[model samples]
Target chain A: MVQPEKARSKIRIYMDILQAVQDDGMAKPTRVLQKANLSHERLTRYLGELVQKNLVKENQDEPGVRYYTMTEQGIRFLQELRKAESFVSGFGFEF
Target chain B: MPFPFLYLDTSFYFLSGIVAFLVSFYAFRYTRLIENSALRFLSIGFTVLGVGLLAEAFIDTLSFFIPSTSSYLLLHRLIIREAAATYSFLQVLAYFVILMGYLLSRRGPASAASSNGSMNRPPTIGFLASATSVVLASRLGELGVLIALAREIIIISSALSMAFLVAIIYLDSTGYLKHRNKQAILVLVGFVLILASQAISFSLGIVAARALGFSEILDFIGTAVQFAAFLSLLLFLIWRGKIGSTGKSAQ
Candidate 1:
């Protein structure tokens, strides 16, 4: 069973991926794989979910060969995540 | 007024000494997270040796400033003996700790061919054994025997270790090795440099002990080379980002 905490952590991972892409600007799947240390299997599923949510878009013809970019919604999501992280850490609940 | 050669040497030693202390401090502070007990012990021993060498440098500087005082000379002798003894003991301890780590890192090779492979053995043991032999030879005080035996061992061990280090670095730089594995390579390179420098300086010390006019300059140069090597190793550790955060996450 996927625990609630594990699901939440995945959300954070998604944000981190987006942040890394934003920081590096146009990273290939291979680069992301190395940087994030995520296996291909796990990355494919999570990336697919993000595409479904419209938080990220896929290149039409290239499919899995596409690079990930954060949409406006994804950017907003990351900002909120950061705010929450700051608040929790300020309360001595360090991550 | 004499260009403060002594002051310059002492300052460099002090700076390197502080750097070593900081490296050890970081190691100890993050010890809970480090999975490798041998690396932890080696780090602690390196720190102790750094402190001892730093104290020895300070004593040498004092001897120069108070060169004519009988009491000062006595104090200098005492401190030098103490520091050298501590440094030697810590160095040997570090060698054993690193050897243990190398052994542990090679547990259970997959194939029989790879089981007794050269890579599985402690690469730095040769260098350490050479160093110990040189020190023992120095104690014997026989010039021909010391030079012949020590030079052969030190030169052979250093050349082999240097080649191994270069190969590892090349593999890592080309991305043929994984990130964590690259870290292990860096650690090995750091230790190899330390051992190599010590071997060179010990060899020089043997020659300087015999030479009459060049004794002071030789001693200063030899110590400076060692201090520089140690400092470089510490800096490499920092650059590799090995400080803070433990190996628990690594496993």
Candidate 2:
């Protein structure tokens, strides 16, 4: 479970959405909205960006219910982000 | 007055340089992953430092290989002196930029993580060019003597910068303890060892060990300690990567 952060940057928000999707395994729109704390419009816009960036993929199993899944690049990006955060945080930064 | 344990000292620096360059590679990769200017600066700083250490090692090796003729000796001296000055200057600059990155991270995380807008050319390049010019200029006429004198001062200042880096990392480690971060503890220990190494190097002043056995001993100890510091960081990174793959914290 990812802890909800306050006033995240655009990048941070992207990370949050990715983490939420990863946590959910096959993230439904409502679950991601609740986890990312973004309105439908905002979530839609960011999800498009994430899909375009190749960090996230939008898939539908049956019909209308869209599930967001993290791509390989997305997972790698998250891992790198964690390492970078820890690297600098070792120097007292809340990265 | 040939140096004692010269090969050992150079080997340690070479190993340390290899480690620094490895870390720099990963840091630079991370900058591409994230939108953090601090990460970019940190990457650049470590790259400069890694290259500087390697340069020093190369210069030391060159001294041994250069033909001992009078003209060769003069050329050798000029090359080593200029290289040493540049190495010292880079040491200071690298540590200073790293310090600035940490400071910026603390003050305004947002600003520090912001994209490099309008920063067409990094300030580091200008610093290197200017510092190189000043060091090269000191190689002229009567000022050459002054450069010889100033070389010791530069080395001392470089050691002090290392000390300053240790202090900053040490302070940062206290916060790490509060967060119960094992990785940070490893980094703290590494810096402490590096700090001790720099202090020994500063006090020894053994560019040419003139039968001073104690200075040689101190130099050996410093080299050994610095190697350990680099090893610690390397191990931490490796261990952290393993844990990260498992989605767990080492703490």
Residues B1-251, candidate 1, lDDT per residue (tens digit)? Answer: 22246677677668767866765564444332222233344345546556555765676576666454554543443333333433444454444443433343223112211222122222244335545655776698744555456434433434443444344334323322322333344444544455555555455445533662364465466557656665665555554343212211111
Candidate 1 clashing pairs?
A: B33-B246
**How do the predictions measure up, each by TM-score?**
0.45, 0.77
**Pick by DockQ: which candidate is best?**
2
Best by lDDT: 2
DockQ of each: 0.04, 0.37
lDDT of 2 at B20: 79
Candidate 1 structure quality by residue, lDDT tens digits, A1-95: 86343222454467556656555566566666776668898877877887798876655346556776767776655554443332222111111
DockQ of 1: 0.04
Taking chain B only, the TM-score of every model is 0.55, 0.76
Error of 2 at B43 (Å): 1.3
Error of 1 at B95 (Å): 3.1
- What candidate 2 gets wrong by more than 4 Å, as runs, is A1-6, A37-41, A60-64, B1-4, B66-86, B115-151, B174-179, B206-211, B249-251
User: Model 2 residue A14 lDDT?
Assistant: 84
Residue B213, model 1: lDDT of: 39
lDDT of 1: 0.48
